[model samples]
Target: MNDPRSPAQDPDSGSGLADWTAGAADWIARADRIAAISRPATEILLARLDPQPGQRILDVASGAGDPAFSIAERVGSAGSVLATDGVAEMVTALEGRARERGLTNVQAQVVSAESLAFTPGRFDGASCRFGAMFFDDAARTFGAMATAVRSGGRLAALVWSCDDRNPYFTVVTAALDAVGADPVEVARTVFELDDPEEVLAACRGGGWVDARVEAVGFPWRLPDTRPETLIDTQSELSRKLRKRMEGLSADQIERARGIVAERVGQLEAAIQDGDDLIMPAECLALSGRAP
Candidate 1:
């Protein structure tokens, strides 16, 4: 998992605290959209975790609260979910969302995955959605998660499978490349653990038993949206993309948008239904039980 990009250029380098903190506002603004796009993966993780009613759960790196909120509903008022993120701003946003939804069972905290401060065996289950890949040390984070969950407690995580299987990433990278943008360096980190074995190893190293990996494929659908909207949302959500875009001229930005639109139209897995767009996405779900 050695990042090829220099620390100065890597958005995910170190703890990625700064990058995530800075992007909190944007993520909060697009929370609903992000949740919609990642709903399938969330569902898969939730199923794997199999959280039971009256059981406490831990959700790590819960940036606008996805499965956290969903888990709260599943656990009901009698149970609870501790949703955490390294960035305080993200926790604030998560708290606001929880309050807005009247999810009294959900609690938001600024806690990093690598340094979870919860007592040992405090939770019945733990889940991390699209967060394992960004962890500075996946095994360490998993180890912390293991410590938080009771023995035999379930643990599940979702991560991008590969660049090839996920057109949502490739299309954007292709468009950026077509416009002479250096997206390759920034985007490659997304698939650092593309191999299922890598996830299994991390789980085992962190004291998780019966670790297993599964490939989950689903359509990332956006109803009443166009390719341009997707590109715009990506630019705003991706810190590196936004920084790169800052240097581009107005004409170059427009060109990149057009390229993205064209590429989206040509994707084999992309389906156009009325004004809606569906792009194929694949992720690896790693599951195990605390030892």
Candidate 2:
């Protein structure tokens, strides 16, 4: 997937390592929120992968180890899982989780999808959950992923579909607009590389065979959400949006928060006990076999 914007113009252009590392580290602290956003989708991905014992699997951009650790459980002691991220912090968090779960078959490492430091044809299968979309050189990343897996091995990834297809993100967009923040830039970053053609192009570029795309949808609920957490999450979104929507005012930020809070309130009421907020999300699950 070639970038419409040149590397010189993109944060991922020359060196996205530092920024990506820091971002993942900071975000790892919000493990619960991360899980809320991705767990259901991850479950669907694992079910699709249908990992078997005695097979080796690699999880690229394993973020906090949700997909990686889950894979480990399925493979059991006979199978092994290498869960890697480009950020050390993410690997650390993943390691911690693996320890907690006594998952000896799972190991975490710091590695990138574009330049994985593994021997060729070492893995039986590889998977990435909402990870490959951030690559500066997506084609190179896919090629490397292809090289890592043995012939006939599987390549699977879970990525967000277009913005309109996802209400969780649309709600965020609405809040940002209410706050008078320019959201085009952040929105672009969020969905720019998510097009189906680009994804298939990358996979084909990497020499993957039988590439197929699946659409998965499920309800994601945030239970026990605190007002403070809601405000904080909105603020975080506002900050990210600020990178694209310049000149965001405090008043606008407050307004955005109020609107999002109201939406959450309605969702909470729908929970029957005013304890949770649920929204629907759609994702693309792309898979292929390495040649």
Model number with the top TM-score = 1
The residue pairs found clashing in candidate 1 are none
Alpha-carbon RMSD to native, per candidate: 5.1, 5.6
Off by over 4 Å in 1: 1-14, 182-188, 227-229
Residue 59 of candidate 2: its Cα lDDT? 89
| Residue-level lDDT for 63 in candidate 1 | 89
Top candidate, metric lDDT: 1
Tell me the TM-score of each prediction against the true structure.
0.89, 0.80
Query: How well is each residue in 1-291 modelled by candidate 2, as lDDT tens digits?
Result: 221211222334344454555366457776656776567987888876778988899888887888788888888899999987777677778888789889999977777665575788999998988876677776788788888899999988888888766656666567766666664422124464568887888878878899987777776666655442454544453446445335766676667667766775665332322665556667888889989
Q: What is the C-alpha lDDT profile of model 1 across 31-149, one tens digit per residue?
A: 98889877888789889999888999999989889979999988898999999887777777788889999999998777767677679999999999988887778898999999989
lDDT at 274, model 2: 68
